[model samples]
Target: MANHKSAIKKIRSDERKRLRNRYQHKTARTHIKKLLTTKDKEEAQLLLKVVHGMIDKLTKKNIIHKNNAARKKSRLAKYVNKLVATA
Candidate 1:
């Protein structure tokens, strides 16, 4: 469907970027879910750090909005804090 060579290349590159972004987003969500289910405060804290980094990277890449990333990080921190308080 692409008429120009540059347009064809762009399509290919876009597809690759899309797949990469999807993978990163899915990985971050998986980590977040694991963190939420974890009962150990120490382990959750570690996971929070990792998840935060992933979220920051997603924001940096424009895969997710900055506000969305901030909200996610905030909620995760709150959850971890609650876990710490409970245990």
Candidate 2:
């Protein structure tokens, strides 16, 4: 239990931020899953643009690390390229 008013406020603020981060992270994961499952190269390419933008926003906000975002984009691009290669 926080004894100081400032500490209490800090805890509340932290909780709100935590929840917001979780939601954004989960949403990003969902989009990533969708991208990974998509078999059509054209659709995946379009989705890649949207997902990349989302990842950039998350990285800028400090919700996700820059390296993590870069890794995801790399892997997704690889997958999208493979789809075209296979067809």
Candidate 3:
């Protein structure tokens, strides 16, 4: 569909970036799920750091919005804090 040489190149690069972004987003979500499911406070605490870092990276890259990242981080921290309080 892209006729111009530059247009074709742009399409190719966009596809590559899309796949990479999807992978990173999925990885961050997996970490968040794992963190949410863990019963061990210690393990959850550690995973929270990794998840937060992943979220920050995504937000920095503009894959996710700043507010979206903040909301996710907030929910996770709240959940982890509740776990800490209960245990």
Clashing pairs in 3: none
Best model per lDDT:
1
lDDT (10s digit) by residue, model 3, range 1-87: 989999999999999999999999999999998998998788888899999999999999999999999999999998888885334
Residue 20 lDDT, candidate 1, scale 0-100: 100
lDDT of 2: 0.91
Best by TM-score: 1
Of candidate 1, the 10-residue stretch with the lowest lDDT total is 78-87
As a whole number from 0 to 100, the lDDT of residue 56 in candidate 2 is 92
- The collision pairs in model 1 are none
1 or 2, greater by TM-score: 1
Residue 71, candidate 2: C-alpha displacement in angstroms: 1.0
What's the candidate order when arranged by decreasing TM-score? 1, 3, 2
Error of 3 at 74 (Å): 0.8
Candidate 3 regions with alpha-carbon error over 4 angstroms: 85-87
Q: What TM-score fits each model?
A: 0.95, 0.90, 0.93
| Candidate ordering by lDDT (highest first) | 1, 3, 2
